[model samples]
Target: MRIGIPQGLLYFKNGRLWKRNLNALGIEVVTSPETTEGILSDGIRHSVCDLCLPVKAFFGHVLALKDNVDCLFIPRVIRVEPDAFLCPKFIGLPDMVRAAIRNLPRIIDTEFNIKEKPEAVFWQEVRRELKGDRKMLLRGEAEAISTNEILRCAQNDRKRRNDKIEKDHRLQKFSEHKLTVGIAGRPYLVLDNYLNKGVVRYMNRLGVSVVYQTPEKNYIIETMSMLPKWIYWSMGKEVVSSVRRMLEDESIDGIILIANAGCGPDSFMTELIDGTLPVHKKPYMSLSIDEHLSDAGLQTRIEAFVDMIERKFKYN
Candidate 1:
């Protein structure tokens, strides 16, 4: 069967595993095109203003595939990697998109447990759902998951390495170039184009170097564990550390957080950052994007933020 997968959200982080597992079962997948003005425009036309850019972009991808494929794979992240938190929107995106779309297709629900040794719980659940004889399901589950894990590990390693290289390249070129901008957001929002509206390129246009959280995944996750015990939220720890590191980096003059309108985690942490980072010699700003892709609005906000950065860097 031809399965449709939206290329935003968790797809960026989990595509390799999904592709391998689906292909093992002889299913073909169709993916939405990368994010562009057209998709953002459609999102603006179709989405309510209160939604965030990533969710709206998600809505656009669903609309794009409404008639184009047999099934749409929207996986609910009950949780990824056990204790690491995903935004609550992730848990309900499938149901939300299902309600919004006029047309619907079959969906593959993967409620797997990954923290319990090599995805044992997840594959057991997957095989149970796949409709095969007892023996066949067992064999398929064991083989498909093991293969998927190896591939995912290798690919993640490559990504981390490439991120390091990119960081090195940027530092070499911009060490003396002087302009700097701090970027704070969820990894998905900051790195995925279909989600963040190409803010990286826009930052480049403003003659700024990006200080992002991508290069510090392990460090961020590690430091997240250090947050006070009362704050049980996993994301808060990570965002706090990410912004703290950015503020301490002398090369970063300002920070920008692109937040989702309803994302509870970012909404709380970014406010703390906006209030306090300036005192630490790092100024910050946030632009929440949902469906409003009107160039006039985006450009104006960006221009104002850029002006703030310029003024601060020059005077302070």
Candidate 2:
């Protein structure tokens, strides 16, 4: 059976793993096309008026795939790890889609709360919900885990190689005109080109190198330890920790915070990050995006932010 996976929300983070698991189970997966004006428009048309931009985009993705697939895999992810939860929207996403959208294929809205149950249990629940073969499910889980480990190691190795290269005096001349700016936000907003109106590419065109990385686990723990209160949202911790890391790094010239216009967690996280910036004395800007945001306006603001950074570098 063809199962459709929408390219939105947690899809940015867990899409690969989900695809790997399903493909290994001998199922055909049909993913919606990348975000486009049409897709976002479709999303906005069907979704509630108050929904965040990402959720509206997600609705569009679901509509894109509803007709092509026999079923949809939109899991209700509550807690992936202990002591942390996803946003309230994510916990209620499947139901929201059901309520808002009409005439959808069968939804595989399995609840995934690894905090309460082991990951193996979660997989078993998914297998049962999908009616997938038990052996194939186990095989898929194993393969996904192995692939994740390899990718993690490769990313670490590449980061180390890049660090070594950055330290070399020969490459310093090449970076003279480039300003490294750290863009911190939810993966969905930061990584989705159409959703963010190609901000990363625009920054590149303006001679600004953008960096967005998930900080290592130890670094996240260390950074969050200094906060007055713990961040309970998984994505919030990542954004906070990554921003802090970028602020502390002397090589990164500036930082930008990207957030959906109505995201509650982001509202708090951005303020928390902003409070720390005065001490670091780093140039920072926050971009709040919605469906109504204009491409030209975003570009103009980015150009101005980059100009300010360039002036700071020149005078300092």
Candidate 3:
């Protein structure tokens, strides 16, 4: 059977896992294309104005895939980790899509909460949905998990190598023309070029090195310890910890915080980052994006931010 996966929300983070798992189960996976104006407009048309930008984009992706796929895989994700929970919207995403869009294919809206149950329970639910053999399901899940772990290890190793290279270069001499900027945001907003108006590419074009906040387990624990209360949202904790990590890095010249217009967690996380900026004495900019954000406007603001950092580096 062909199953469609929308390329939004947690898809940026877990798309690979889902695809691999389904593929090993002998299912054909059909993914929606990257975000484009047509996709965004279609999503906006079907979605309510109050919904966040990422959710709207998700709706668009579902529409794009509905015609071709046998069913859609919009799992109701609650808590992946033991300590952290996802946003409320994610828990209701399947319901939201069902209510907002009509004339759709069968939706495999399974509840995936690993925090409460074992991983085998989720796979059992999937097996029931697909009516697959138990042994095959077990094999597929084992392979998928092993493959994901291998990828994670390789990524961590690459990051360590890059970090070492960056440290060695810093000790040599600082480049006059280049500046490093840390970007903190949800993967949907930061990685989707169409949604963020190609901000990463624009920064690269301006001769600036861009660093993304990928928080490690130790970093998250240490950073959250400083706060009075815990960050309940999983993505929020990641963003806050990433911002803290960036602030502590001497090489990061400035920071750019990106969030969608109507995201609640983003608002709080940005505030927390803002509150700590004074202690670091770092220049930072927070950009709130929506369907109305203009490419020219975004580029202009980034140019100005880069110029200010260049001036500070040249003088001080």
Error in Å for residue 107 of model 3: 1.2
What is the number of backbone collisions in each predicted candidate, taken in the order shown?
5, 0, 0
Candidate 2 lands at a TM-score of 0.85
Please provide TM-scores, in order, for all candidate models, with all chains considered together. Answer: 0.73, 0.85, 0.85
Query: Candidate 3: which pairs clash?
Result: none
lDDT tens readout by residue for model 2, 1-316: 7889999998877776677566655678889999999999999999878888999999999999999988899999999778899999999999999998999988988888977886556655665676653434544444444434444543454456423422321223334447888788988888787887788878888877777767877898887788888899999999998888888888888888898787899888888887853534788889988776568988888999999989986998
lDDT of each: 0.63, 0.79, 0.78
Candidate 1 local accuracy as lDDT?
0.63
Number of clashes found in candidate 3: 0
**How close to the true structure is residue 149 of candidate 1, measured as C-alpha lDDT?**
61
Over the stretch 181-228, how does candidate 1's per-residue lDDT look in tens digits? 767666557766545666766667767777665435677665554443
After TM-score superposition, what is the CA distance of residue 90 in candidate 1 from its true location, in Å? Answer: 1.5
Which 10-residue window in model 3 sums to the lowest lDDT?
Answer: 165-174
Model 3 deviation from the true structure expressed as Cα RMSD, one decimal place: 5.5
